[model samples]
Target chain A: MLPVRRSILGLMDRLMSFHRGSLWVGVVLVVIAPLSVALLLSMWRSPFPINEMISLLEDAESSTPGRFFDPTIRSWYRPLFHLTLWGFWNGSGSLLGGLHWFRYLEVGSVLVLLLLFVSYLRPRTGLQAAAALLAVAVMMGMPGFRDNLEIPVLMTLVGMPMALLVWMLLEREHRWWYTPLILALTMTAIGYKEQGLVIAPVVVGAWWMGSPGARRTTTAVVVLAVLAYLAMRFSTRGHWALFEQDVGFLFGELGEDEAAARFGERPWILYGYSALATIGNILFSEPSRGTFVITDHALSGETRPWEWISIVSSTLMTALIAWWGVAILRRDWSADAWSAESRLFVILVLALGASGALGFNYARDRLGGMAVPFYAAASYFAVLSVAERAGAASLKRRATVALVLVMLAGAWQLRAVGTLHDVRLRAASTHRTWITSPNWSRVTFAHRPRYLSIMQTMTPQGTDPARARRPTYPEWFLALIGGG
Target chain B: MPAGNTRILAWLIAMPALLCAVGLPLYESSDVAQPPAMADTFVEALDDRNVEHAYLFIRQGQDPNTLVRFRDDVRTGGREVQVSPLMLAVAGSDDNTAAMLLSFGARMDYPPNRYVVCLAREMGMDGFVDSQMSTASEVECPPPSGAEFPLLAYVD
Candidate 1:
């Protein structure tokens, strides 16, 4: 009969129904298309930093097939992008490869993305959840790396704070191992690339949101970071460090001095401004008079308009986050503040700010718009908007049915167009000539050897008409004729 | 109420069946009709630098002996060379291959990325140049993307 006991019972009922619901699975299945589109477009489009990456992936003498040493000091950004593509490939190998797998991950990313948002709907964008979802869904329908597409797989790198945020929101007691996982990830990011710097603010923000700004938990994390740095230093035994002379030579050799020479010298503030604006402009609109300016993603060649919408949605969501933070800082969170809902809102806001900052800063160069923090925050914004209003049996059936139909259509479009396109079917290529025939193409394209040799033999010839005109050796035909 | 709900449900079920039966079939023909030669992994078609491709293949999980066999079959005329299987991890894991890759090229003295310590550690740089025990070969980019970029196929 106690209020707390009654509340717990009410919560259990919803959780049970959610698990039992049939639509959740359907929802998962349908979002695949959008992701596929995102992947294909990302792949087929011109690669970024191509000259560098081309040598990185190809040159045998320059560390092709694998690197023995990090070639670039900026290893984080380069490796981070590779990992996102890797996740789509690894996670989807059991299923069909290509757009289909891409579609699945894309939809999964969005649905999960929305789930993050919904978890905070009542706390933050309660009234606007529907419009927000619709906007994000429509945005998701666009083809780009930023939307509900390739960004999800970088969950290990960018989503750390959001993951921690969700954990804190649930406030599940007895969480011991989360620290190690987070530390390993942070160290890996650092080890993996400088882009790992993004994890810091995100985790810090998570801490600020969950506890009252900074509990002993955050202090522990800070301590762990110092220890982690020491551990890395000890493990590598100071090998990673360059002498000051080397640093001077590396930069000095570039001939960047005023009296001697340089490649485009600018003040540090100006450099920071340019870099900051490049990130800021990608996310939102802010007029500036300085020589440093930024463009709409449309002008940047890194994104299309639809992708820009993700940046927009995320930016607006970021603005709301700013408002929430200001509210918390100013002690103006409604008189009924400090309640559960308010805490949840604060947690999400903190996560958004921290991740957004990283995407804007450390990863802005190598990843450009593809970084995790910004995209995840945008996804959170969109998802929260849609999920908050799913319950309630009082609505008319026809309207409900119509809504479902639209959602199904939207989900299909969102998944197919967005997720499927983003799929990266990375096939392993360890040089071999055993694959002389067309049968090897399946592996080359990262498809399962889905079509058997027979299927391949039957395939039509290309523009080179003589190829199809000739009788291709069939599997049995080959054995009989060649007598191998 | 039951009749209307059933009708809607029936329509929903029928639509997908229609797509799979017709739409999918139509889509399938356009793609499935393409030749198989177009689908092979990037490294499979090379005859030029057989050893290099073999190196790539063996590192990818193909046995080095088989690559060596493929080498003999191809008849490279040059003296047969035994490739150390341990060379694969020299680039760290395949995902961090750039580091190990740089190391693979280290014999020539490529300018090493100064941050190799932290970078190698981040990549979990396993120092087993030829140890059977190893870090998992993580192909970070999709294999197909690997095909198109850099070298579509490697030569011996």
Candidate 2:
């Protein structure tokens, strides 16, 4: 019995030592697994309009920078996103091909984010391998990633990695070119989405949390880039803050008047609920779940009991993770335990808060960039805590706990895999129904005809009409329409 | 890992959940006006040139004369109509009773394109119906005038 116990302890120590060897393998698995799932799911035809591609192509073809900022023509000033899309569309020569390129880009962004995270954790001891893998899995499994595959959402996703890269770069060497490069990246990120402005605050926050240096350098760079962004935005959109124009759509018929009324009736209370709900949606909701409902009446009878169970369980887990994050922040700040990981947690928390404040409703896609830091912090602390406890425990007890955690992680991975498979099945069915439908007049269950009408108006006549059609109508649609 | 730390962690987690639980119901139940799904359907149908389908979605019980006027106004218009679902939802108060002031796009003959669609519940009816239509700038149902039946609105 004594010999057996000694051997097991020796084996556990050996396994711990071997984690370095497994790091690359773990990184590859973490990056590839979700991307493979995404690729498989991509086989289904998208019902969403290729409005972004069409708009970019038109902008490029017309050679009009005016339209880029024109409030009536374009809703927002995202020049970098427009240019990137233009390049993709020009290169691909087809809308579908451009969309496929976006999927690849999205996967690549996820890889970059994972690589950055893994590189940060590689130097840390103990269960960081487990934590890194778990973080990646959690991030990939999020509904936000799935929702962000759509064109508009993909634009925001592009900005996320750019912002993260800027943050990473800022923490390291400060060459003369670094400021210009950081400024350029920051501006480009903003051009992708207004949410990119959150990067400025994140950089500033990170600098504040960072070791004391010429703070003025970081501050000046961020402020200058922001001013430049504002100048460009104002020049193009005729306003410094154009997000309000977009928010008007959320008010429905009442527009700003409804917002005013809601504000009058306890502004803080309304916003507070919005923030909490947004966080909840970010952490708890799965990609395979049905649309989020704000009102009690909107709850569907079809929602399974386990769906409710999953929500509650996820909520509890999220709360615990968040609590742990708060503890880490408190401990680290007080102890002056300033590391890249700690600074990242600070950035994510701020970003999450900023995201909640900017948007009125809970949209999983909007939370995509913010969620990365959250999962990272949660996983890091979880592993650290487990490692700490395991180090102090008996070998038999350590093995039992480690085995249980592995089993839980396995279950999570399997659940994510199962959800993706389910999504693929649904997407395939929806795609088939979308293509086979004869009457374009009536809205099918799988497709919204309203969007199709909008797309027809947006696409230039020179572009193939079939490409603009929903479910991207195959050649059969042209035949059915007598090549109209 | 100490008992004190565990208690502090518990409090930290509990506080947010507690606040959310207390605040969410209050926020949702607050009186904010929003248009019903039926209004969205009606406007969409009108946009699609399916006036009959639009009319079908309107809950019945309006002054016969008023109904005729609305039907004629929608059918004869060369003017474009765009229905924003968010606008419809935001314009009306809770309790299925609400009014929407719609803007009509310029036509060859018409200079101003503004109409009001008022929805209210009839006595003992389960659902709210489109009770009135007017070209008047201001129309209110279940308010100071109290001429229209009050019905519970659907919250989306």
Candidate 3:
């Protein structure tokens, strides 16, 4: 054979190899492709300390362990999330420095999540080496992935998905310490984000599907764990700071009295609306910009060019994913009552439900982070299933079509990442401009003067032109930005 | 035991699962208020010059970097110009609106902002231009295209 053909075959041999060492190497190879793209497109720069201001202030107010559980200090209780911040704060000595550490951890977690997911899929789904890499790339390329990676405080957004994959993997292992292990996992997830409560249902699903031996004790533990969590959660101040004045914010111009009057008796209506809208935002490419929701965008009948592109690409991708899912269920129905395909389908549905329901307070793109992985896994299975059933002649044709859809979705996701990167860069720029302006002192302090002063002191003094314009990654990395 | 029973079990758990999902946020949302109905479409309350609304909106969650067009009535030369809130604030000479937006991280790097810089120079709002330029000496504007843009129709 020619040299090029020989090299190609050799690489394929290595990729298809199941050697213990190479398996890990293959997983790393798979992770790097998507992680590199994500890093280049979204997280190549340090972010402004705007979003993490409250957490930093809370930490400053009390360097005590008790503050983590003090729900009155913030809208909700998130100890593990704050603890991670506290670790960074003490280690890095400034909010911006801590955020840089967070940026690194965010990417590191993504790498770990992908590694665990790829390892899990290898045995269960039997995806080819190349297909596994592609699936991970497409999953990480989802629009919500950008939001998950860029927002430092929203580390739990990424963590919850990791927890979901962990639960799925753990269910397969009927170890002796399963009860405590699962209980610990559940608590850790809840401590990450309020939405981590979704993991409880996941635990229940696992108990139902997995071994019957541990059911009684597992059920007792899960129930006790959930009850304990709720007891602690409800005993708190019962306030979302976004709508309260104590945190120095109000939902738009609506005061607490006005908000209470509006959503008073039937807050469920608002919650339900937000939940549905959040789900719609995930599945369909509905605009979620500024104060605008999909309804407003629809009524206005005005969409930016990129918004239209997102809508078309996302709607088509959703339709394709749904079609592929139905095809898998139909094909696998005769195999078993609960085949691997069916179980995964069930997981996908549950995850989507959890993602939407998590938005009961309000809908944001990051809320849908948990669902994207399952969506990507389902797509992987669907593609493999189709290719598996096709005759040799038709295989190439089907693969090409699937590849095209993946490419389109990938491009759309990159656009979303680019937009996020632009927003962050602008945020950094505007922050520097604001601090340096003569009118900086005259700026209103909606939160607290102390918090603002803390922020001002923490902000890097004097703008470096390079930092203002764009982050200075290595020259080779800079070259990847345009290609990304 | 049976497949059908498992399906039943799934349904049984779903109700509590939902309650688990919605219960916590709702319990905490006892004092929470809904966003304004027009909050979605109206990107900014600059048309009404409602500085308080803008202040709260930015403080709460609205991205100040979002570029919104000025209302049609603010048409120049009988046409609507797609202007950033910063530019419109400068145009109407609302220092409070400009200052509030700027402090909250409104961007001046958008392509349209260069036009705003020129407009600021033309209007002799030198102070506004000076604040935007951190290290620059003077405002620069491209020659006008003399194009007439149409008015944006009011959305119902």
Candidate 4:
């Protein structure tokens, strides 16, 4: 008994030792905590247009491998995303299970992102490590705009992080084989989204700025890959004319009538403002409405107080973050810090701008993938700047200041999360009101008998109009609402 | 102080704060005690064009004559009409008088759509009056879909 007691005590002491315990604790808090929250939040989410994603997935799953690359079948070239969804669906055993698992994948991507940030920081000291963890925590806990939290948006959300991770690897590795490796990775990224094509320019910039050693080889490889990707993309059904028409609308050269004739009544201003508002929404405004309300509602020459507030606050916050980042860049002139900071900042700005510019709508989910890395970089810089300044103070004072910063970041995260929670609850209540209320139910029942039949079918794909007579919701949806 | 100790101190401070940051919201979100107001529900229903639910809210305490007239007006109208009660609420209509007049333009079945108004009045604690009690008025259809009716324009 005495021997066993001493052994237990010894084990406890060893476990609590600085290196092992602290590192494990950091992993749990930084990675596990955020992931758990994401999982929990995901469970609360109801399907937003689950039918469209299921249809697309079904089509992809049934098609031949070569068909995915065919432009006539799909408007865009996103084979990897489609394949991933198909794989997930096949593994999940059921359609609803697949969707639930997809949310877990989204949450897991965030964990991967946090780890990437930690690796990027390469914390040597305990203070730096703490800052890295805090930055990740703040980023993970920050509320995402509600629109981005939906299932279909997870494709973009997951793809962006994967691309960034690959980009980071490309930048860090210096082997002779890296040029070809980066080219392959770049092709993979583009397969996820057209924005993946931006990786080519990013590679060029990285090579120009710091990787002069392998400049020619890297540039040649990337250029070749870009040409190949373009060839493959253009070979698909949709010609470059489709892209040209979009560009024509973006520049407002096409009149409203012309634009409508080509692509419905959507105006160029809608796309421009949506892009601007994506950044604005992230920096300011509540997660619930975002800047979408501003563009949609206020565009008719009427304004609300909250709209003004969203615009003003978004502007101020953006400026503040930029100013803070620039201040740190000026103070910390270390080549490593400067290169990393500047590269990330440029990527963030360009990605956000380009995404908004190219897309027809400003969807929060579309912005979310880019926003994750942007926020991570911003938080890292802010923490690093503070840590550098704190080096001047006494150890105790510095520790105290660090604690305060962590607390403040935590508090900010709390407010954001709390708001998101409230918004989600409100949405659920609204959905319930629509579903259960007498008048609302009557109209839905009468006009949308097809909805009832679809709901009753429970099948995500291969529903023949002649055979499937009942309106059915997905089994997963029923399970989500505690009915299944 | 030792460097290790300083690092330990920093982790100690950060971990608990991080836990609170995520855990607090998680804990708070579990409590689903408070449901949204009926007016909010009505507004949502109206916005979603769930006419049956909207009617339920605006049907309370309505005169039979008014109810008959409202249905007759809808049935007789050639074009589809959409009333936005949420828009009225956004425009600062109180619980007692939140309403929006909807204008129907020229559509497939009807060459010219007439104007109809949906009004919400609080009926004790139950909910709003049903759609039958909601006001309806006939007006000339706007030429273009974007053109607004008098009441709807004000609400917008």
Candidate 5:
């Protein structure tokens, strides 16, 4: 009877602690939402779909030629949550079930992050921090912390919880097992996608930023982890020469031969422009760069003016993020205490993580033009933070007012549901249009047969230099009719 | 509010008028903004040959990647076949209704088995990638060493 009573008391304490933590998170989630949503509205696509990258893993189960790449350690490194998605898919007899499972996980993870952020915020102006978060959200939309491609069910249930567990070490003393958990998470993130490389450095940096006494030891662990990762990567894939096939990177193969084989001996600038033409693919036009700018095959000509904009923006944006991060970290406010330093660190970390998009220079050709989202998010965060600090007026209120105005002006651009419906309605009309209209080129870009034939054949593989350039119906075709 | 600031602002304002005379045309043309287009025939000609260059022209919203998969259709006994007419489009303001047709002209010896189309319209972008499968025996190719069917004939 006494043991039971004691257990109940302990449970109550933990519950109360958890409740306190969650309240802060809830408020911040509200704060951050407006910003995230605004960003989403402006963005080419909702930046939250790291799920697509995760979906790659689940899809691999079915891809046969792809099977050649999968190995034992690779399987082990995959997040348990991503792995679980396959199971859920099998159980529910539909991939959508697994997808929903992930959505719920994402929603739950947001809540958990809110709790943690709030807990961190608590040492400061408690409710004010919540208001700040709300301001942040309203200003930025949900920052791009989550991947659009990762399998969410296992990710939420296993991956994120594990991440949070490691996060606890940032605030409290490290449990002996925490190292393994962090290593495990990093490895899993990598297995989920190659972009996981971006994560490893941030974490190692985070670990080093902690307590002075532990800094050296943590740094050593980070170094060893990185070394071990390299060793594994080399052992498995290093022996195999990096294939110079102009496959996915429309950025052009930075292959030894091609780099040297340039006619002008400088393809970088040219590739930069070509990458810009491919740039809009990341935002407005397609769901992903995956299918359209299929591979290195997508790019053309020299870097264009707009592409230069992409590069400059991405650079300034990255610099801004790095600045915020350095400023925050330098202040010794590593954890979420109320100190200006702590606030700086929190915003810095958020900015850096969000700015560091999972999809880096997507194709070799496109650094500036192709890499827009990361910078956009970063820029959005910087603007939001500046706005919040600038005055007493709530950013949320302003952004909401702005959003309504924008929607009123261009309701068509803001809604996702409309996009989905447009596709359905136009698809049939397009078919009819194509059947009825003999001149294929006369039809809209959607009706082109070249696009149709490839739909089932294979997804986009970017341009290969060796392959002769394929025929493309020009963009001027738009002007062929009225309103183009 | 400062006197120096006001003078600097006046100078800045004067500079813009000088620039606007030059900037107006560019600004006006840009407002009719669209990604620069390739000569219509260059894109169209490639589509006719079912050549590799044709595939490179796929626009936004179109699946230029899936348009010509190399490893796809190995099972169900299809020989290595190259499908043609890479469809890549830009989903316009009403992405569904505004959805424009753009293609990379790599002539496919075979017709498409399926397509996923996104339409541009007032509401938004929506469409289906209609998937269909056809017999593999119809294609003629020397079988790839590892399999019964020929590997996909890469248009390139």
Candidate 6:
């Protein structure tokens, strides 16, 4: 009994002890969490060719490759986005297969974020690992992540952040040729979404902090990139608007013209409110229904049973980060205090602010998608810095208790996300509200009658007209597990 | 700094520019042809109560589930309302038109409320509503909230 006890203690001590190699253990945990959740939750069973997804595919099928580059064809110009739709349609062999590929890509982008966290922070202790795990759980709990998972059109949610992280990771090593490489990334990010410009300031800030010799070249490259991005984006003279004007139309309260007139009266005040509400939504889990309205949701209601879990966990984690920030400011004023981790936390906080600022017309959880990953990284780093400063002997005692509590919080949040995801999946499977919802009607092609013709004829490539059906999860689960 | 980095750098610079040069012209020079004018005629057929013409339009790739906005001048004080073909058919008590739509995978749950079923029952189309609402025990009707008839729900 004594020998067993001694061995267990030794194992615990070794895990708690700081080492560079142990960071890889955290990396492994990060990788496993998303993959396991995706599989267990049966995320790939999403309904395809519904809502805007149907129109996107139909447009992809109808349009020539060159039409994607033509700014006059669409209200917004995102050639890469258009091309991605084309690629997804042609490459996947079927509409069902296309949905599967899209799910994989979304999951893959999120995994890139997880790996980026590991690469950036290099968390060393088991407590740091738990913190990262908790951060990921919180990310999944976020309404933005939930919205993106259900709606593939919001690829920019994860794509924009992934682009930012990739640029940040590369910009650290300032070789002469890296300038063009950064330029390419910038262009591609813009090609993905216009909000890709949001990443520019953070990248420039990072470059400014680096070696003085490289600063001039870095600044020149970023400036040139920004100029080029602006020229390319605006030169075509596509339908350009700073904000979505159809607010009342969105809420089903007023006509489009009436809504436009109302919003135009005090656009600045409305935009400011949208931005702040979005930021508040991301940090404290406060519901913002100004832009994306979710009906019959816990987030929208006054308060519900499990709503407290998301609110409490998110608020607690943010408060801890704030506490850590103050402690760092007071105690560690040296050059080392503004280390890579600290600098990144500051940059991400800026990026979160920028993301809110980009919520130009209205506040929606989906707009916070780019910031959520950064927020997660900030949470991870704060917990890591706190644990590192605490020393191992003291931390080991407190970490165990914290670890258990974090695990419980993480499980509760993940369960909430799963329940919500299941609800979306059920709706998607039925082919009812998923296609006919007012939110979907807001999409560019939803109202077009010609496109509606194309939508009805489309099916999984090999499916017979009689047998072509979107199977609900129970049907899939029964077949797999119960041998139905 | 490294040989591999230089090779990657070359590819990174060349690919996007090349893609834009080759891809842009192809997109800019070409335009997508419009789809055949089928839906307008289909809507017209439904409006005229020409079940045969509507069936022909459905066969010619007109989706029965398509919701087209029309002026409800007499019914709703001149407000435009979006209605599916099935709803139009039900409102007119055109059983053949309704049956044809249902046969071609038109969903009965398109109506925002249970008022459509109430309308069908009033029209003596109990068999059609019964077949569509097989799962529900009964159609629970609620009082209409607005001044206009509930079936012609307002649209912006």
Q: Any residue pairs clashing in model 3, and if so which?
A: A291-B40, A292-B40
What C-alpha lDDT does candidate 4 achieve relative to the native structure?
0.48
lDDT of 2 by residue, A120-236 (tens): 555333234445555554554454554554433566677666766676677776666666777776777777777677677777786787623315686688887797766765665
Better of 3 and 5 by lDDT: 3
Give the Cα-based TM-score of candidate 2 against the true structure: 0.55
Candidate 5, A1-484: lDDT as tens digits: 9999999999998998777666645644553443233222222111112223333533534444334344433423343444545555565665445444545555454445434443544512232432333322221111122223122222322233333334445345655665566666555645544434433554554554553222445546656776787677666653332223232333333443543355235545434433433333333222123233222222554433323332333333345445655654555444543433343344334323322242222332221111222323333334334333333435576445334322221221112112222222322333333222222322322454443332222112112221111112234421221011
Q: Each prediction's DockQ?
A: 0.02, 0.02, 0.03, 0.10, 0.03, 0.03
Q: Can you give the TM-score per candidate against the true fold? A: 0.41, 0.55, 0.62, 0.56, 0.40, 0.62
Candidate 3 lDDT tens digits, B1-156: 233432332233222222323442443244235433333333456666655456556656776666665545444544545656766666666666666677667766655454555555555577765654452344355564333421222111
Candidate 1 segments whose C-alpha is farther than 4 A from its true place: A1-15, A18-171, A211-219, A226-266, A285-332, A335-484, B1-156
> Which window of ten consecutive residues has the lowest lDDT sum in model 4 chain A?
A462-471
What lDDT does each candidate get?
Answer: 0.35, 0.46, 0.55, 0.48, 0.34, 0.56
Docking class of 4: incorrect
Residue A198 in candidate 4, Cα distance off native in Å: 3.8
Please give the lDDT score at residue A445 for candidate 4.
48
Error of 2 at A208 (Å): 0.4
**What fraction of the reference interface contacts is present in each model, in order?**
0.00, 0.00, 0.03, 0.14, 0.00, 0.00
Candidate 4 per-residue lDDT over residues A1-484, each given as its tens digit: 9999999999888876755645744654554455445434533443334245535655755766666656566556787777666667677875566666766776566556656656656554556566566555445444343334444555555555655665576457477777766777677767767756656666665665563333677877887878877786667645323222222222134443454565545445555654564554456542222234444446666655434444443443355458666764564556444456665665556555655554444334345445555665566566655656666778788777566565544444443343344334443433333223323222334455544443333322221111111113245422222111
TM-score of chain B of each: 0.27, 0.27, 0.54, 0.26, 0.25, 0.58
Candidate 6 wrongly placed segments (more than 4 Å): A1-31, A34-41, A90-104, A158-161, A167-172, A175-177, A211-215, A232-258, A291-302, A329-333, A388-408, A419-430, A433-453, A460-484, B1-156
Interface RMSD of 1: 14.6
C-alpha lDDT of candidate 5 relative to the true structure: 0.34
Q: Sort the candidates on lDDT, descending order.
A: 6, 3, 4, 2, 1, 5
How would you class the docking of model 2? Answer: incorrect
On DockQ, who's better, 2 or 3?
3
Best by DockQ: 4
DockQ of candidate model 6: 0.03
